[model samples]
Target chain A: MPTLEDDDLVFRFPQNCGRSTFRIAFQRTLRIPDSDREYPLPPGLGTFPLRHAEDFPALPDRMAARGGVVMPMWQAEALWINCSHAGRDDLPVAVKIAAGKINAVTGEAWRPGLHRDPQDYVVAPDQPWLDGFASAPGQIRQFVAMPLGDGYTAEEQITGQAEWGGLQISVTPMKRAAWDRLRKAWWPGLGERVAYLHDNFDRMSMGLGAGGLMRQRIEEDPHDLADWDQRATERVFVSLVHAAQWSALTGQQPPTAPPSAQAYAKAGLPWFQHYGCDRPALPGASPLRDLFSVAELHKAQTGQVLPGSQDIAAELPVRPFGTRPREVRSPGGW
Target chain B: MQRSAAPSFGTHVRALREARAVEDSRFSLRQVAARCGVTPAYLSRLERDESPPPGAEVLVKLAHELQEDPDVMLAMGGKISDDLRAAILARPRLFADLIRALRDTPEHAVLRILREVRDGDW
Candidate 1:
């Protein structure tokens, strides 16, 4: 008579209504050594206790005495076993399992002891397990067998998942100084590369459009639009730069800048003519006359320090630009 | 068989109350439950189809509150089809993670990506 109290294994199954149902049952006990507080089982062996019924009731009394309960299968959806807390001095922690099955058809109700593994059970591939695996390594391994899914390769399956996955199943200790050094050295370099790509390839060449198209067509097609857009944008920028370089070497109008700079001068910023051409006449009633003064523009355009230029800079408060207060608070303060 | 679509619990409750309007002007279940000195949960359960239909005295009280004939609200409650259970289960989560990912990403980047994606470049 294995009651709920004695159960350490649970099974999850689908009901006729397409809903998940859970079941609880007892499983065999583990004989933990007194010297070793935590035990690490070989890969695949972790799920073995769940497969059998006869082994449940016969589990060692010591394990059952410590409140070793099994988790309900549905709760095992994204299960990660952390052995770090076991047998610490503060208080003895116990592993307890709850058993139940979800109704497969209606996705409702819990039933006692019938569980189905994804391998043995046929579920729509879009189940949460599969969906989650798209961004993470989804692998199940035993000492002898290793199964892999998306985000997993043969080398990763063997080395990352099998050899190291559960071997060091402890919490990682953190050192702030070491972490800061690593972040400073690595992150900025990475950010610089990302920023460069964003400016030159992504923004300048319009690579982002490709990314959007790819996502919209992901289900229908699997192609790298980012690469294509990158190439196209690069070509355009290259051509423009090449034309400018040629003009600089041959002393011709560097087509791209001349037109845009001309437009700016016509619009109002006559100072923009300094880039490659002569300054245009100031417009009537324009603030440029009052702001620049003849001496100021001459000094700015010619790179000579005029006495009046120093006076203007001094009068302008010398504060850096873009430091205006974001919001003005009331005197009383809310 | 293509399952016949059934109304939701809220919809069914509204329909039943409306149908009994002629016979009982104030025939709502809340007033009847109050008059009988019973908690609203009990009346709510009956209206939601979670419990069996109310007794005659409860119905008479409901009819007085609604100001309708006693039998009208009762008849309307009985007209509730049992097929509603399946419809409730058919609704999907609607928005998936992909939509969330799109919404959460920066707008400028999203526009750029969409343009490239639309152009069949990616």
Candidate 2:
């Protein structure tokens, strides 16, 4: 089971699994223009607040059935999944993130089991954060929210149905033997990792859809399929209610919308791009590729322009950091 | 139900150790005690709050075995880390004034101070 410690959803594995834990946070970020221009990663404004679905009275039936946690988001708001681990940052935890039952990485229908050939899941610590759908090699379209049943959602667009309107995440950790081998081979005397910070919505149920593409890479799975503990997987379904609905249901005001791409650029805030190792990125998912941006879909369906669909400014300054070495393939410092 | 009283340092330690042991046999109290070079009986007493917090050196060992930050373990045990103490002593008046001045400040304010110092964002 995943627990909401502060604002982070923490999934802790059983003791036999070395007490491996993964922390996931929903980060508020700029909703880049849904135009043809791909943009650099926007700064994380803050985390969205989360509450236990069970804590509130009279939850929507689907949300009650899911029974994990609920968070509110403004329609068209963009978010990124921040991934980290307690105890060890390098802990190998495989995470499969799906929005409305559509696989965020593979752009395939949701499946209970992990996959490798196309690498349907991302490994935490190595991958760090996921900004959006895996659109192209080393590139992703950002995760933007839209109301369900609106053709804007990946669920409705791909599945021809909008049955699920929230996010589903399942995590699997590395097998003990594989983890021990890596730990011993790597930094044997490594110090404890500083824990990641936990930091926080609306009333309508929303689903994630592809937005502007960004320069982000979902790292190739560095470990073999056998290295993952498939039998011991934990899954959680996150219900994203509309921010206005958030105030109505939870009696708390939802967070204000994030700054526009123009406002962010005007402030000259630093945009980030992590420099990673030479591990090749997975080829873009076919189904996720060629999907219409929310604005384009809205325009096509309604013959009306989507609000906030203006083109993003070009030449947003990019600050490169984190020269990450490939930890898996590196030989022993022991 | 809300806990009536905050757990004592020993109760906290015992609970943390036992919980980890229950999930993983490698963390069984005796195993942890052995790893930390303490007797199982003494460790049990420590958990029961019958004994005072262990010395800093012993607490460090326990912290490492328990996968907890040594500084946190020291603080929970009502002790200051030796290095932190030395640092404080290095600038006795400055740190003394700083701690006293910030005594009643809110946590967020303290965090802001820390961020400013760490980032040199003056």
Candidate 3:
């Protein structure tokens, strides 16, 4: 079950699975200009406040039954998923993240079980954060929020339907035996004491639509597929409620509006460039390749224009942040 | 999950170092050890808990280099800095009582007390 810990959703595994936990947070960030020019990664503003759907009145029964959480987003705000492990040496958990039932990596429809040929899910602790849909190699169209039923979401663009309008995440952890064997082989020097350290949706609100392209590579899984415990998967639905509806349903104020990409650039805040593992990157998904950006969709739907549609030319310095690549220590000698 | 016991001083130092290193490559083991005037081999042993935690000078240097509060680094090393030790020794009973009274309180409450002490009218 996933518990809200310090604003991050902490999914704890069963005792049989060594009780390792995965933490994920929905971070609010700048909505890059939806233009042909790919932009640098934006800075994280803060986490979007989340609430259990059951705590409020007038929630859809489907959401409650699926064990869903709710968070408010403005019509055009953007978000990114932040993934981490509770402790340093815990086993990596495979996470399948789909926005509105469309796989963010492969752009396939939501389905049970992990996929290896295309590698649909991300491995936590290895791939720390997912900013947006994998559009191409080392490039992702940023996730920008748009109201459902208007035909801007990846779900609507790909599926030709919008039945599910929220994010779905299911996690599968490594089997305990595999972890023990790997630990014994991988870290022979470290003593035993070190080992201990390890929806719904409703749609009524918004779903993720691809925005501008950013430089990000969704890494291919390094561990063998056999290591994952396929049977012990836990899934949750995240419903994105619009600010007004959220206030009406929960009777609380929604978060302030996010700053525009242009404004943020003008303010001289450092954009981020995450230096991740050197693993091979997955080829981008085809279904999501040609989806219209929010700006493009808005321009096509309504004759009126949105400001800052053209890519910002400002030279926003990119701040490099990443794990220093260490020597790859393999569990030698099978 | 509850931890079996509090982490050792070496474990805490390694965790802090690694956390910083993960955020920025400038804090890599060799880089931090070099910046803090220590050998990487010795630092690695200290991090892996094979060696005892270092004294206040190294801890203070590491705290400064890692952008952590010096007091926190000293406490994590299971040592009170000389100045703090002198202050405690000057009023041992009162300080002990104050520490005991505040130990069980939440961090926010302690922070509130700190703010009051800083902004209070003497």
Candidate 4:
């Protein structure tokens, strides 16, 4: 139950690309037990956990990796202030405030000064605690601090990083519809890739996906999962997505490639070649040997010969299973 | 079942001083500390809740400097009644450990424990 001090007001703004800039403006004032000296902040300045800070740094990377940036606006741009009484059984309520610029075109700043009128509102502690403080009336609203980090899933990671004093704020102007479309298109495929790795956990001994090792260990021993019971499996999946997306955005090479033929051979799995006319003798052919040959895999998977050549479809398998499947109509057509 | 109010005599004195725009009125911590006969660091700590309550004499002196009533300062600290204690206790973190334990428990088990605790009707 720490009290507010005058010096606690900290303002942070981005120094890089205009696309990444976000300003955090707040003032900390002491609340006397029964004083007439009341100061109510405007609705624009009241939003808790402002969105600009959380969305900026990761924007450039997201733009490059995911075609267009996906910024969660309404959910990400709120501001919050933490206030709790000392030695109280009740939890601290983080007051959420709504903030918006008077005019984005004018570029004006909000300077702290006396206001003749201010909006008054009361905020409950936790979402559930809202019931207890139903009758309480005050200009200040309360909010609960949201815990966030690596352990949280992508959806759960929406919470701010409180300890760093870094508010999870996003300043991007990307509309919700655009962001939703991008995420919808991107996530399903990403989930499939991650699921593939998880299913073939034993075969995946190396690579960025290998970090799933911890997850594999948890799945191996149910006790491990129970140790961190509050966490859900979706949280783990989110962490993997964050890790993979982060790597992709940063352009850092994945530590290892998907399991190679050698890795499969080591695991005592048969190595078979499905395509390519220049098939080497089968006696020593190992899947690990062909795993690194991306050029051949592409040719094999597509059933399309090299660009400059005139190889006909007759040369390849009549109906290659790996090639794109024929579009089928729904069984229950209108 | 009401508990006695805890003393917040210190916060009262500071708040009154702030309201009067006493000292430099520049909103600088250093100016306020100098006017209050204390070091800047100590004043900063007092404002941030790092130190315990300041003395009555100091409170009186701060009230005088701010041109506010000493009694007003004392009342603001909740020294006049025990209601303050109940209010403070009701604030968040009063049962932080218990809340955290409940939150950390397995979701299924937590429901059962909550049911038992509620059924016990404490």
Candidate 5:
């Protein structure tokens, strides 16, 4: 049970074949008031977790005493953008949701008469893991996998991302030692067949191995793409960006003035509470600090905490997934 | 089965049901469903095109309650008679005529033509 906690965030990696867990006790969500729309944190509070289910109770918690290690978090469907035009740390942040980059707020289509591209973004093929999850050959899941407000692949993929001055954030796998610990803990039995068993889309996602061979036999069953949220996508895929190529994915030009700093802040942009954690080496501050914040939170209503507390956090570290994400650069530049 | 897009086989189910109810004020959703031995909710879903039509027996029962042809109801519910479909598929010329009739003629007329073809002199 390697663990780390700060305020309301907690990360737990269990023994037995299971992946590390990254969860938040309290989630910060953005709502445009009366509208039903919600955005994933950029940095959303929790990128969908890559989960595995094994009988950890049967195994010993040997790793519990390994002392917490420093590991990086892998937020699902998120990407990074390094733009000099962004507001200062204290700069105002605002949000403008749109089909492409046009003012979806004002109903002015990005191209006036031109048909808006779907989700206003495209995906790249460089990251092979997405093959299983892409809605089409080289496309990505729209509302389900896309961040609260960014686009994907080809130069056109990120057309509107420049508005927020943040391109889609892509993360590599954890370091070999760190990933090995999770991999072995998660899928100990399968060898190369592990890819088929990897976790994705939180625990909601179904895996081939999860259903065994019978599922694969009927894997081609017709699915209603409209019901995407009902389905689970792959997790290992790493989306890449080729500025020139990325723009090619879209028809409209990336918006000129990204959301004013004020709009970005008002959009309720999420601040990662556990970006860089204090030493996981220590028992972490306080005796029950880990569960203290949870205890203090009002049950609110029965339904919020029912079906078990959604506030439980996964114990994973913030580390480099692959070498590329560490250095932000254009596609081949890395 | 692949979910249909628009105006699938079940497209006309609701309209046909509404027409039946109008013709016979006694024709009610609950009453028709009872004759078919199904819950009104299930029958409502079937009529609204929200559900696939049931087996042949249920289709026949519901058609009888509405005083409509079973084969026509089956087609409106996106269900095709397997024997009839297979027979049409086995012949190129006959299959072409069936396709033309289905596209150009009304369901009642098409069903009549198909039956006459199946039962009449070659």
Candidate 6:
């Protein structure tokens, strides 16, 4: 039995593995919050069924158009990290499809950092191999690395992944109860209007909820969800100043919108079927296409230096990391 | 009415071990065998129902280590302490709660509580 442990969760194969090669083990049954209620996540740890767009067999000629695919995740927050590269003339576009030892999305020099402490969890997107749905047009969003416990289900969760063997991609949602308390207090409760926002929203939109010092840092922001979301974005920008290394400069948090219909066309990223711009006519289309607007706003904030990585480990550990987060300048030293 | 055969002691051991695994990530069959002073092969035989139940001393040690009640495990192991069995059979719901507690609660903490219950009148 492949078993691994994280703080409150225990991930193990509940049944025989070789008997069924496709399934992934969950630490516990995920509690997915919805519009009306909270339900235990159904047994899902494999490829979500997918179909092709523009290929209606009956209408074959349309295939020449912007070729795309139809896909859906039970719960997902289509996110993108816009690295801030301000002053580097040598590096034109910091974001590249990464390969071995480098981040898949940002192309930052990423070697699995040695676990500095129990909290030093590395998200080895490739190890214990997984093949998930690709999001962008032409761009294969191999590992949709999002912070765990952000309320949003990551591509990793839906497609299935093996235990962290010690390498962990940090996912945080304080407690289901606490997440609800913040939601009930802040959201405009616009029903379906923002219901499209997510029964499981982004971690940035819901800043450090109710953590002692963490809560105090953002206490000054507006309590209303929309206003707070803007503040959260700004705070992410401000966190860049704390970066100690040049490569850390491009470190940005996950995008807030589902990728827009134009996400691939415009921003070079995938729009999550559920969270991005609504294409109501399609089979698995969603009504939440705000990522395009989000990307535009973020693009204005672009810089030449690489964005800095967020140090979630620093806060949750209740102390400094025993092994500091490893920092590299660039694939070649900047 | 037809009466069903009760599960054997080995079955109970397997069940408890699975529950213990949830709370203790590193808890393993090999580790259990070492603590029980038996070989992995022997413990595997017990869990697989190939061997007879172990002795009193081993059962009692397992209960202490796993933080279960020695008398209760002894009865479940087919040792059948009359007074203990009578008390447990009379309180089915209470016995269920005990099982839940054993599976859910940590060993050291549960043992401490069990100790207090044993020492105090309550």
Clash count of each predicted structure: 69, 15, 1, 43, 56, 31
Q: What TM-scores does chain A show, candidate by candidate in order?
A: 0.15, 0.89, 0.89, 0.16, 0.17, 0.18
Q: In model 1, how large is the Cα lDDT of residue A144?
A: 11
Candidate 1, A309: how far from true, in Å? 87
Candidate 5: stretches off by over 4 Å:
A1-334, B1-11, B23-25, B89-122
Residues A240-307 of candidate 6 have per-residue lDDT tens digits of: 01112212222333112222122222322211111112221111101111111111212333532112
| By TM-score: ranked, best first | 3, 2, 5, 6, 4, 1
The worst-scoring run of ten residues by lDDT in candidate 1 chain A lies at A207-216
Q: Write the per-residue lDDT of candidate 6 for residues B30-120, one digit (tens) a residue.
A: 8988888888798888888899888877888777656566777787766855656687799979987887868656644554442110010
Which is the leading candidate under lDDT? 2
TM-score of 4: 0.15
lDDT of 1 by residue, B14-68 (tens): 4656665444655466654677666768867866778766665665555545444
lDDT of 1 by residue, A1-334 (tens): 1112111221111111112212222111111111111112211112212211112343223222222221211101112221211010111111111101112111222222222221111111111111001110121110110111111112122122211111000011112333244346655554100111111111000000000000000011011122111111110000001222333333434222112212222333211000111222111111111111222223444676422112111111111112111121121222
Better of 1 and 5 by DockQ: 1
The all-Cα superposition gives candidate 6 an RMSD in Å to the true structure of: 25.8
The root-mean-square deviation over C-alpha atoms between each candidate and the true structure, in angstroms, is 32.4, 15.4, 12.9, 30.5, 27.0, 25.8
Model 3 sits at a Cα RMSD from the real structure of 12.9
What tens digits encode model 4's per-residue C-alpha lDDT throughout A1-334?
0111221211111111112211222211111111122222111112111112122354333222212111111111112232222111121121222111111011111122111112111111221111001111222211111122211111111111111111121111222333345446655663100111122121101111000000000001111111221111000000011223434333433221122212222344221111212222112112111111112222454675323122121221122222211112121210
* lDDT tens digits by residue: candidate 3, A211-310: 8889888899888898888888777778888876877888888877777778777867677787688898888898878777787778877876656566
For each candidate, the alpha-carbon lDDT, in order, equals 0.23, 0.77, 0.76, 0.25, 0.28, 0.28
The sequence of per-residue lDDT tens digits that candidate 5 reaches over residues B48-99 is 6688768877877766666555677677665766666787778969778757
- Over the stretch B1-122, how does candidate 2's per-residue lDDT look in tens digits? 24467678898898788867766798887888888988999999999989999999999988867767688889888899877899899999999999999977875466455311010000
Q: How do all models score by TM-score?
A: 0.13, 0.69, 0.72, 0.15, 0.20, 0.20
**Interface DockQ of each model:** 0.02, 0.03, 0.05, 0.01, 0.00, 0.02
- Interface RMSD in Å per candidate, to 1 decimal? 31.5, 18.7, 20.2, 22.8, 36.5, 31.3
lDDT of candidate 5 over A166-219, digit per residue (tens): 111111112334434434654545310011112111111111000000000001
